[model samples]
Target: MKLWEIAHSRTGDKGNISNLSLIVYNMEDFKEVKEKITAEAVKKHFKDIVKGEVIRYELPQLGAFNFVMYDALGGGVTRSLSLDKHGKSLSSFLLNMEI
Candidate 1:
């Protein structure tokens, strides 16, 4: 199933780092999200876009996972040649990931 079935996400960027937070709608699904969505999995998911490391922070209290992706924005927003490279939209793309 797609990750979005159980969660939603928020995204932001600074320099070449991209931030994405995956938040589950129900706390009950938190365990599965934690198990399936690892930093390695996410890094592979966006291999074409993210050129550096993917770091995941588990927020059990919030039932969310915050990911820090380096070298992800083509050297930041202002420097990226692609118009659709905004971090905000990439969060949606990540929702398409299947667990």
Candidate 2:
């Protein structure tokens, strides 16, 4: 399923980097998410569209997961000119994601 379909997302942009905070619902959901959205999976999905790092965090107490994607805009939070990064928008790209 799409990212939004599986979890809620909060996005912030700083320069060329975009941070995505994902709050998953439960353990089952988290497992499914991890299985489908592996680091390699993200790299392939955003290969040319984003640069930098994609970090994932697990919050067992909150039953949530967070993803911090860095240098997505080619420069990072300090030098990106465009706030919207083309059709490869986070929300849209997320729709194509299985997790």
Candidate 3:
């Protein structure tokens, strides 16, 4: 299962520190999302590309979730680089995932 399949859609930035906001279809699905689509998961999935801690946050008010993946590119804002060697289209890539 891919992150995007279960998540509604993602919105955020790339290159430096990335903030990825995801919308789950239903609240009940939060567990699955948390358990399966995790920081380690992201690291493992895109091992060569992603790095750092994948922190998750829950927004009950909006019935949404957000993942803040730190140092994902490589080092920090200025030095970190992406697998594409350019940056990622996170929303589209996540949307294409199977989960």
Candidate 4:
């Protein structure tokens, strides 16, 4: 199943960094997400666009994970020439990932 069915996302961006928070629909799903959604996996998933490292910050109590992606915006909103400079659509792309 796609992660979207079990999770939702919130996003923030500053300069070339994209902060994507993935919150599971239920606490029971935390283990599944934690196991499958590693920083390495995310980095591989977004490899084409992400030029820097992917860091995963765990929020176990909240059943959530926040991924900080560097060099993801092509540079930054104001500086990037890419169409989706803020990389907001990347959140939706991530939601479509299958477990």
Using lDDT as the measure, the top candidate is: 4
- lDDT score at residue 89, model 1, on the 0-100 scale: 87
Error of 1 at 58 (Å): 0.9
Q: Which residue pairs of candidate 4 clash?
A: none
Ranking by TM-score: 4, 1, 2, 3
Candidate 4: residue 71 Cα off by (Å): 0.6
For each candidate in turn, the TM-score is 0.96, 0.70, 0.64, 0.96
Candidate 3, 1-99: lDDT as tens digits: 665656675545566566777777777777777666666665566565456777778776676767777665565446744454324466566556555
The deviation in Å at residue 98 for candidate 1 is: 0.5
lDDT per model vs. reference = 0.92, 0.65, 0.63, 0.94
Q: Per-residue alpha-carbon lDDT of model 2 for 1-99, expressed as tens digits?
A: 577676766667666656665667555687777667766677678787667777777776675656666767757545556566432367456546765
Candidate 4 per-residue lDDT, tens place, 16-97, comes to 9999999999999999999999999999999899999999999999999999999999889999999888888989988988
Looking at model 2, which ten-residue stretch has the lowest summed lDDT? 79-88
lDDT over C-alpha atoms for residue 86 of model 4:
84
Better of 1 and 3 by TM-score: 1
Those runs of model 1 whose alpha carbons end farther than 4 Å from true positions after fitting are: none
Which regions in candidate 3 have their CA more than 4 angstroms from the true location? 74-88
Please give the clash total of every predicted structure, in order: 0, 3, 5, 0
- lDDT for predicted candidate 3 compared with the true structure: 0.63
